[model samples]
Target: MSDSKKADQKKAIVFLCDGTEEMEFTITVDVLRRAKVDVTVVGVNIAKEFALCSRGVKITPDEKFSESLSSGNYDAVVIPGGNGTASILGDHEGAKKLILEFYESKKIVAFICAGTLVAEKAGIPHKHTVTSYPAFKSELEKVYNYSEDRVVVDENVITSRGPGTTFLFALTIVEKLLNVKTVNSLKNEMLTCSSL
Candidate 1:
């Protein structure tokens, strides 16, 4: 590939903090890459090279969060849920800023399961539709329009319930970054049960 062509390639990053949900994280990454998005799985905690997912899966990331954030060239960032999300994203100013920057720039910012709370903490508007684990449904209803539909996309933000909805959530993202045509083709190729 030519240098400019490489530079123009669509890029995405999946942020990995310690104890991220393994299934959601990997499914999102796998699907996005299948759609031909140049994906970089970045370890959010710069001090670590690997994130031990909540299911005890160790993921070595492709880049450090510091580098990805400072570079500021990705098309989007994906966040997967786990108990660690609150401490890693909800409480951390860097994570909040990174997400806010993406949203403010009109870039896609997607979350699944409890990761929706991170989007909320990062200032996702309350009017945008979203969904999360049922345990958070009540609180989420008070903030944003709650949807029981497996995947919810409102504005540039996409969210879903949990692991069961991972593929749908990922396909929704691919639709946004690329198009319905691409996602539909991908779905047929993957034999997914549904479409966006």
Candidate 2:
């Protein structure tokens, strides 16, 4: 990558924990990278080296959660949900801290599936409209205005449903960080529906 190109590239940090939904994590990363975003996958677990997904797929993150938090250059912070992903991330003070930092800094804070609960756990002030897995809609409604849209964006915060909505969630991130032009190009090449 050329120096100028690297300088212009948007960056995102994605958090991954044991039992994370594999498709949510994989599709988000793939879509972001396809849009030329520099994505750093962070393993937020004791293992530090790898995390076993809900489907038994093992993924090695690009960095450890502890080390990745200090960098404020990222354009977005993403969290993917699974069966127990919310429980795991909710208990981690570091995860909460990171989300708060990014959100308060006005950077994009995106979460999908049960991951939406993680943001609520981080103490985001209520009343911002958002969405999540149907199972978590009530819980999130307590803090957010709650939308049924496949992908909801309120200011710099973005939330979506489950694995089925991951592609749209990621494409939304690309739109926010890059442009509609980039997203349109990717959608055409990737053959995704023009839902955006």
Q: lDDT for every model?
A: 0.84, 0.88
Q: How far is candidate 2 from the true structure (C-alpha RMSD, Å)?
A: 1.4
What is the C-alpha lDDT profile of model 1 across 9-62, one tens digit per residue? 778878888888989999899889888889988777634678888888888998
- Which pairs of residues have clashing backbones in candidate 2? none
lDDT of 2 by residue, 42-76 (tens): 88773647898999899989977784574388889
Give model 1's TM-score versus the native structure: 0.91
Off by over 4 Å in 1: 3-5, 46-48, 67-72
Candidate 2, residue 28: how far the Cα is off, in Å:
0.2
Please give the RMSD to the true structure for each candidate, in Å.
2.0, 1.4
Clashes of each: 0, 0
